[model samples]
Target: MIDEQIFLSEQTQDIYPSRYSNSPHMIPRADPVVYGSDFSNAPIHRELIEQYQQQGFLVLDNVFSDDEVLMFQQELNRLSQDDALKQCDEVITEKNSGDVRSVFRIHELSPVFSQLASDFRTMELARFLLGDQVYIHQSRLNYKPGYRGREFYWHSDFETWHVEDGMPRMRALSMSITLTENFYHNGPLMLIPGSHHTFVSCVGETPAEHYRQSLKRQEYGVPDDRSLEQLIDEGGIVSAIGKPGSLIIFDCNVMHGSNGNITPFPRSNVFMVYNAMSNKVAEPFCSQKPRPEYICSRKNIRTL
Candidate 1:
């Protein structure tokens, strides 16, 4: 077994440089849930739930307005340039190096981020997919610049994030919304269909090891390969390409990752991971455990 501390240090090195980059640092805004009580009645919202379950993923085109996407992108860019967020610059994955120069929990940064982190549409969708009692577990903005080679390896989000027996196959869902145009050239998101139903255990590996293996694979390297296309042809995978404002919702257990950007411009997106309140599973035992941070700011929310 990997030593817990060593394992954690590796994972930490794989993600950001230190704990400060991952912990919650933003203040919360007024609760958006208080704005209305009839969220379950939204038609498109209902459709989102059905589509997610049937296909194991759903793409909502133009879910955010172009203006909204631009605004968020501006904030992300501004924050990326700040000294506080840039402290962990050396440790970020190569794929995320450009836009995500520094990593900070969304809720710890600003009220707008906080509101979006706990948006009603998102929370409602989470409840619909996982049940009414759901919690926002992790959230981050993934910044990808054009021409960067740091693409993630094909893997399930749940594989490394949950306890063994107590794992909930469909306990959580993740939402990735593009803040900029995402196309084949810009490393759009990719997913393997029905892989969520397969039980594959992801033993905790150092982030560095994960990065090295991904870099070695030609499928993830430049000049784009046919492997992803073949998967799509075989009905095994799907490419999620969309303009800014589109959202892709998928089961946490689904096998997914992105290719590196080969375009001239950068692509940016924000992600939030929500786990059904009913499912309380611990992360798999790692000799070196990277402590999980709260995505939502509890201090800002007025408990009902």
Candidate 2:
């Protein structure tokens, strides 16, 4: 279970109630507009844009090489066995009995991760999706052990919690990179397309509760207690199953979340969130703050 106290920190400023717009239902839809007109001249194929516009997400196969994945995975496993990582008791949480889940802020822990966080291929794709000047706001590794466990509640990363008119575009895109193969049987990610544009008030609630309510409001017909598998069969939901080197990049507004690992092996992955660096925003919502330099130094790095 997520610690409720963490929500009260000032660093989590981007997450708060809005004074400008009423609840999601009351806010009028902005005029329907096609994106990617002026900002990025780089030839992002029409299909890629269409995919994001229609589904709120897109998958890139084999973004990392097999050797790279193996190296990163080895490094992560090594870190897991280290006393330093184990001593980060504050960031670690327990679920479903004694199964401990470690949430490591990768940029601070691993050089490889920090280098990859600002990698060119990633930044260029981000620039295409968002605009120029992307700042990596957060990076974390979730290590979920194999076994029976409480599911990770479904929720959006950008939902407001405390401040009014939260920072605009503070988090524009989030990239989830699977360190290991995330097959359907191992609790892969499941998301509802086009749910990003629909705002939901999820303050003070667990992810599971927020997800259930969102589905009901959307009339998606997903039962509150249904497993992710059950929801997928009903239609529209997509499971992001891929090889270890693949990645799924989606807008922060997207409604995305995952379940617990039921397979005998552990399910592990690293998540990195990037935001377009602009002056229109205030402080972020989470206590995991990034340095000002890190935010300002982003350059366009493209890989062919």
Candidate 3:
């Protein structure tokens, strides 16, 4: 096993320097259950802080205006059709129809995306969860096209980042803002409410392969049929069904996945990862070097 303490120290010091002196375990998992009814109305309230800290996830409605979301929708559609943009690896295409599957690194690609990253509402909530100076770790727009969108395998993001990107611990969170209505029938994201508390180490050398295999076989890192039986029996899965402009904040270690969109309705959303500057990534464990800054950002500039 790796000397987790020293490894953690090295990770934190990679950029911020001396911010972390102890083991990664020094950061404990949040409580499992918290808050009461009527919490969503005032999510910024301190009481609800525990709600997210405990369940490892929180869903908020109407974070963006409908007009803003429509503008973004139009922008993404336009970009999807641009041949110049299509040539970029950031724009992934579907295997069968050749339609766009996802667009990565949009924080630098669009002004609206950059503005969203620095938005006060997003920044305030991110700071509450990730500390005062959080940086954008990754950003992507997932377009689950009607009837052809693929399934994302069940897995904790932190697992991949930890081993592949050299992140020492789960001091990060993801905020997914919906650009289209996410009905249950449209392959909305599914989460095991408290799964973030447990780390699942399914065998996989790279997340890309794990995802490719998962979409093809439904057997990638997602809990196996047997394991699913136990995890669901314990925590139960929750479908993230919401309208356009709905925003969800989730822990990086949360066990989550979504089904393939076989229905006619398309589901698209933008998700950005906010990583604490104190949790900077160290040297890679599985690769000879770290991924490019576009994928795994190294900039320590505070977005908020």
TM-score each candidate: 0.69, 0.70, 0.81
lDDT of 3 at 141: 85
- Model 3 Cα lDDT, one tens digit per residue, 1-304: 3799876765455321111222112122432222223445433886557768667788889989999899889877877778998888677778778888778788888888988887877866776576546788888887888877788778677765665567766788899999999998988999987777765555433444333333234442344455555667788999989999988989887878888888999898988998877777777545446656666777534545
lDDT per prediction? 0.55, 0.56, 0.71
User: Residue-wise lDDT of candidate 1 within 50-134, one digit each (tens)?
Assistant: 5555566888897788888888888777777676656542214343343452244664465666687667666766665664566
**156 Cα displacement, candidate 3 (Å):** 0.8
RMSD of each: 11.4, 9.8, 6.7
Residue 95 deviation, candidate 1, in Å? 8.0
Residue 168 displacement in candidate 2 (angstroms): 2.6
**What lDDT does candidate 3 reach at residue 289?**
62
Candidate rank order under TM-score: 3, 2, 1
Local lDDT at 286 for model 1: 35
Assess candidate 1 and give its lDDT: 0.55
Q: Highest lDDT: give the candidate number.
A: 3
Off by over 4 Å in 1: 1-48, 88-104, 163-169, 202-234, 281-283, 290-304
Model 1 TM-score on a 0 to 1 scale: 0.69
